[model samples]
Target: MSGRKAELVEQVARIRDLDLRLLDRVSREALTLDRNWMVEYARWQSGNWQTMSLYNDSGDPSDVAIRDCEARETTVLEHMPATRELLRSFGLKYMWVRIARLPANTFLWEHSDYRDLADLERHRLHIPLHTNRSATLTLGGARVHLGYGSLWRLVPTNRHGACNLSGPDRLHIIMDCYADDTFRDLTSNLTLDDNDIQWLPEATDGEISAHLDEAVALGKLGYHQAAEHSLLKLFYQYSMPEGMGYDLVIRAYEMMGEHARAEQWRLEKKVKLCLA
Candidate 1:
């Protein structure tokens, strides 16, 4: 067995916390950035998830077309000296870098990334600047709070999602890089503590039925979007069979006599979740 597999069991786990730490200066500089520069980008996100690009192909802060490119620092990074210094210290081949913000009651729906990128050895890293206990990521049957001070490695190919359940927006510097010796060395000390993980409890049949009924009620009241969001949020709230949230949405639509909408969601489920 390889060294990483011997330590982690799975070579490509959903998320891992590295022993590496980000400089306090960098975190402070990141927090000093004005929020007005942030632009809302609609990707797989379901709610108020915004981003300000630091590095990309076009140098446009709003142009968030993530792909393998010779990324250059955008004008937005020009004012963030500490952040720029930190990135230079890493010396890794970066594909894209951005400052991501997830406000209260926001969510990034369960989905894998990098599906459209060319097949290569790439990884995603996150450094939290401002966050709260309510900000968490869920994947592989567990929820994680990507706490401050540590650099986190996330395998974007795994089906995962994130949410900030309540007040106080969350901020993190997100980096996508191609694997190299420096990148390997940075993750060599990857470790996770039991306290960092919150295993989700499986939803009971009764609970599932109750949730479905609530969604149906909202749908009948002309709050179809809210109803759909309620069902989709189940993935973060409970550990059930894979794709159960999407199934609940389809079932709720069917119960409301919206067969066309139900079928549309069925196709959406396949595409969004990348179901085979």
Candidate 2:
């Protein structure tokens, strides 16, 4: 890692709250706009987690894979003037920007980002538009909610996952910005409140076995994906070593006589978590 990245990693650790002014106008406008969320990046998530790009490489909202490039505003931004203005106010070099929605019971499985991008300095920012307490981001053995009224910075290179356990959709404007002098200055100060963090404890062996049995039961009843997701959701609930949830999923598949799927998940775990 570069010196700048090393400093940033030390500052953020995993995730931190930023002391930026809130823009309620943008949040309100986001709720009223026509959201044409596209389902992409199936490998990183389970259930109804989707994205609609505002700024992307091709200026196409449907092109949602996050890549390193000079991003341009898509047609979706045309309907979101407040959001557009807010983006401009940041005065940072944006790589990609999108409106991501994670609906009820959705899960973004444990993974790291920027794994395939060039060795460049980039970071992610999140502004909550609409959300519920049940919606939380899990990383570093802690669950945190990036509540509205402030910007949240996440070092996407860390192993992490997210979930919305209950009803109602969780919406946020996510920005991937390349680091510059202005960006560094903007994030010179960050705060992580104890109240915002729920540190998870290590899952007991019995608890782990019970979850696996439940997942296996679900798989036997023809809810294979749900079964896998049930095990995957454990990452958000209790602390485990990296990729343990995926291992449980593989075990579930093996018990269900789906050896092919078991092997596939073994590979998927490595790929999604960037274990290789």
| TM-score of model number 2 | 0.90
TM-scores for every predicted model: 0.89, 0.90
Off by over 4 Å in 2: 1-22
- The residue pairs that clash in candidate 1, if any, are none
Per-residue lDDT of model 2, residues 1-276, tens digit only? 545334434434324343333467777777775656789888888866888899988988888989999998998878878788888888989999998889998889999888899899998988888888888888877788878777778877888888888857888988999989988887776766665677788999999999999999999899898898888888988988989999999988888899999999999998988887
lDDT of each: 0.80, 0.82
- Worst-scoring 10-residue span by lDDT in model 1: 5-14
- Looking at model 2, residue 155 earns an lDDT score of 79
